[model samples]
Target: MVVPEHRVFDPASSDDRSIYDRLVELGGVHVFDTTATQLHSLRALLPTPPEDVLGEEVRWVHYPWRRSLVRVLGPRGFRLLRLDRNRNKITAAEQDDMARLCVGVVGLSVGHAVAHTLAIEGLCGELRLADFDDLDLSNLNRVPASLFDLDINKTVVAARRIAELDPYMSVVPYPDGLVESTFESFMDGLDIVIDECDSLDTKLVLREHARRRGIPVVMETSDGGILDVERFDLEPERPLLHGLLGDLDASALKNITPEQKAPLAARILDPSKLTPRMLASVPEIGRTLSTWPQLGSDVALGGASVAAVVRAFGIGTPPPSGRIRINLDAHLAAISEVEPTASGESISPANQPR
Candidate 1:
């Protein structure tokens, strides 16, 4: 929808004392703070208020900020004002357009961070989140959660976090994860989809469905903050993984065991590009861990990267299809293991911490 441009009278504006008078008369409220945030109401963003103004319409909206509730009022007294804290960073026009788009994300392991990043940055106005997994003690490292969140579904936790940040943004949680029953509703009307799921088959299925609908999918890899964009919307014939996994159709990926997943994933990701630790662990799948290694630091970086990429795509300036690998190791110094020197004495390398 084209957002109609109309002049808004700010109650706090030096040029508009009439606006403040009108607000006081209409039982409107404004934040008591000196920071001059625009007065807003429960229907702050709505195009128009209903004819029957309920008794609650006179009530001041109390927003939970910091440690207390901050009471603020609406700006719909004499003029329609738009609430935008993003300012020059995100233009009012862009924000208006962004508010219409729906973005869905699957998996709340690493995806929890992605959900947080997007919601906080206002990159997506509506987020449909799916994940059957509950928060474990291990998830605290990467998921931006506290001990209080343990035992709760990751999707529910993420939704609460987003609500805390931006209550105006809509967040729908799928506690059961994405299943055949919820597929259509989850993907419906979404401009783009985020695939951060751990399962290979699910990822393929998501991409396949998204491709058919001409909806682009953005996936962030945990190791190196790799941003994978399959612009199936622009290039409908483009294969999943950019056709890297040749002839590895959805049928081949379905019903596969973890042991079977190891080699196939190695091909799609090019095992040479994987970290030494991850590369070593893939072969030990049945013997050791059931899933790939993931780090909190990498998940954080990947989440941030996805937020930026989604904004670009949402604004119609999407990055080209391919991988953009951002390796933190290149920037931050990491410890190296001791190795045997030429003389056979064990020694630490220059990069290794003493």
Candidate 2:
């Protein structure tokens, strides 16, 4: 596993000067100092006036993967400034509450987007990512990765990106992927689990463990923007995948090959509800298509939708357990229809906007 390396340096400490000097000498380092802007925002967001002598304690964070060093305020001030814009929408108290959550995500493809949104929004304090596969060139179409990231483990790639976005966030990478032996360690202390992996068997196993622990599970299938929120936390006895598999034991599907996963995956993501393109593409996965087609647009929407559900869960207003769709194509199709105008009025055909 290629773990991400980072360190915080307090310039006032003589003990940290030697290593900081070495990093400077290594060269090719990009330095960023935004404490001035941060302080400006921090003071504005505070309820009451702070101390007369507001001494600024700046910290420098070094990311070896990107070879960049950034300067910012201390943790409290940094978080306040970084997430200041989320105020009112996600009040200061709510933001603080979210920071205490530990979210685990399996399957780094769509999981990558979920983790990115969670990190960007400061939705969780710690994130655990699991995926055994490495980045392939074909994944670039939907995955936000480049040629330089080729061959890197998916978990490592997502973790490094999250670290770069928020060094304050704690990211644990499971490059070896999830298995029966490692399941206990992965489930330990997870407040919520997001399933994005492709394996039908792995999906069942994740839900089973989460149900036993009474932790909610969130899943978003990029097809038709299908989002499944199973609130096992509230309904501990809720059937796995909403009982779509009909009492199918996860153990029976263990070690199943990729060829066998397509049909099962379709069952979870009902084929009849899929978009015409996706429904058509499903049958050609091993034939005409490389794999089930996934658009970057749909994946991006899935990320935002998943983050919305997680935020609701974080704020103590969890949505009911059910499969919901936020299909853009369907919405667009509705827009093309001629519905009655607001005020019981109807626009003439010639008056309609082109």
Best-performing candidate as measured by lDDT = 2
**Candidate 1: worst-modelled 10 consecutive residues by lDDT:** 1-10
For residue 246, give model 1's deviation from the true position in Å: 2.1
Candidate 1 per-residue lDDT, tens place, 241-284, comes to: 77777766676777788899889878867788887787899999
Clashing pairs in 1: 29-73, 40-73, 40-74
TM-score of each: 0.72, 0.89
The segments of candidate 1 whose C-alpha lies over 4 angstroms from its true place after superposition are 1-85, 333-354
Q: After aligning candidate 2 to the native by TM-score, how far in Å is the CA of 157 from where it should be? A: 1.4
Best by TM-score: 2
Instruction: TM-score for candidate 2, please give it.
Output: 0.89
Error of 1 at 192 (Å): 0.7
